[model samples]
Target: MAGCGANVTLDPVTIPTPLIDPMPMSVAVRIPAEFEDYVHEDEVLGREKWRIDLGRSNAALFSQLFNFMFDEVTILGPDDDASTLAIDALIEPSIDAFEFSVPSQSRTESYAVWIRYRLKVYDSAGDMYANWPLSAYGKSEKFGLTGDEPLKRAAILAMRDAAALMIMNLDKSTAISALKDRPAIAVASAQPAADEPAPREKRSQLPKRREVALPPPGPAAGPAVLSMDPDSDATRERVPEGSSND
Candidate 1:
């Protein structure tokens, strides 16, 4: 708090429509109150105080991103309840951590931002199906005397990085596409005649929701290389040679 301070506010971000077929699923996304008005404050080398406000940017980004990814999307506010809605699946997104580095601290001409995001998927019965954590990074070179512009650009780029990663890997990681039309199928098979008992095989027909093991609470590895194009050679190069056990 002793040195110069910078306050950076981000505008809502938009992602380019991905050139892929949308999943045939109707989904709901719940945006929490904290995700709508997120702010990060930190001191750099005990000299500079930085305050970054991401007001409604995360909510806006996810809203648009999901709309393009799924056939039908319903946006839910913090107070909204998903149990009343009929959908194939429900998704909740939250920020796990945010970090940045200034040129002075890194001894470089670039400003870097790192964002860790968590996505939780649930079936119609509200059972958690998948929980995935992704890290995105962005870097922007100093363009002017002040660091505000570069920092904002870096934050925006990090968001774009997240969008790209989700577009490319969401279904592969979470198997969300498999939930398409599953709710309707489940409802029809769950009910039985009042006089007759349900058959034992009917219960087995329902999709089983398994718990996803989360990594231990700690810092994850540094953000992977940033790429705006998920199909680009650079992005593909990052993929492991063999199939992932994940």
Candidate 2:
């Protein structure tokens, strides 16, 4: 008898920075009221430490994303509106109107963030903007990596993906079908005129599907008849009747 087995090992995961513009953006975060004191390490104790850590992680993610976008493009803010603007206004603390899930692995954790934001465009009163929800989850069995570096890198990567998705979602040009100038093609609703009958195509009515009875088989060609002379000298005959020709 022989035994065979495979040694399973997971390769350590190395998260890479997301590819996106490094421009900064004037974006603000609306953390959950429940997370207020959670950000304070002294105020946090025991298992609550995990909760505070999560809060800090989220805040950092938002800050980094905003900075990156700002570096690339100018982000408009509520202050841009003269009527509703405050020169030294502070971003209000609104409810975490968006729902998300954070699932962590030994080497990698999944991060998802959804923000119910209000984007004010030029001259137009803005509507509620729910940035596209994002999700990332994976694992790594890498060796010789620094502590927590892998996790941080993974978080950044996830955040980058999230940002790209949000931008794409907001871009109207990408959605040609929904563009204002291009409405859905119209389908005619009027009934066809009765005087103009539909064209009739000549169909060779599938040769009446009747059972074709074949004509009774003709008599087969009669076998050829052959004749021979028994008295011919050329033909030798056996002794006749009772007479023996000695």
Candidate 3:
């Protein structure tokens, strides 16, 4: 074979897949004196009732969802360290809440609490792209045998339920984002000062959001026309001008 100035073609090499990033979360609690509204007589005293700080207890449960991330949970006080996860909560006025239904009876009335929370999850760049607003009713019996224990228990469970709901959706966001391909270029690495604590501004503040109005209610049905009148008249008549009678 004669030697020629020929260039060899090189095929492109395939890159290995990127690793999945773990989901991150933070829980913020807002406890107020009004929490006592749901407590029963028995819960008013003793060590058990003391443990039932609904806001804090609920925050603890929510913290577990992101416990896998070390030193990530931030328990903020009226003035405390901001959390990496950046969840905020506000306590609203008490509303008509429902406690667990009686085991044997179907109907029961319980006190309900309304809590509004804002959760902001940021990407590696510390920019928040996912924001969630969570609000729900927490119910506890007004007066029960277990006393304050039931109230405390109810608050914890209710808070857990609300957090679980929010977490489910957030987990999906992470999974979906992970499956996407990474950016082609490398972003600049931002190292914190050796002695300074991690940044906590994004999580502490809420970004303005546009208002979304709910769909309007469906058209109202014509006043239900009675098939027959109370006097046994088959003819139908509009009742009292504003009402309908058949």
On TM-score, the candidate that comes out on top is: 1
Among these predictions, the greatest lDDT belongs to: 1
Worst 10 residues of 2 by lDDT: 207-216
Give the TM-score (vs. native) of candidate 1: 0.74
TM of each candidate vs. truth: 0.74, 0.30, 0.36
lDDT of 1 by residue, 98-132 (tens): 87877777777877677878887777767666667
Clashing residue pairs found in predicted model 1 = none
- The pairs that clash in candidate 3 are 43-148, 97-112
Question: For model 3, how does the per-residue alpha-carbon lDDT over 1-246 read when each residue is reduced to its tens digit?
Answer: 332111211111111111223333333322223432232211111211222233323333333433322223333333332333334221111212222222122234442233444444444333333444544433445465354443343334344344444434444532223312231121112224578543433334322111111110011122321111111222211112211111
Error of 1 at 103 (Å): 0.8
The segments of candidate 3 whose C-alpha lies over 4 angstroms from its true place after superposition are 1-52, 68-108, 142-146, 172-246
Candidate 2's residue-wise lDDT over 1-246, tens digit each? 222211211122211233444322222233333432122121111111111133334433434443443332122222232223211111222222322222321112422222232221111112211222223221222244444443333323333333333333333412212212222222111122577532222211100011111110011112311111111112212222321111
Q: List lDDT for all candidates, in order.
A: 0.67, 0.25, 0.30
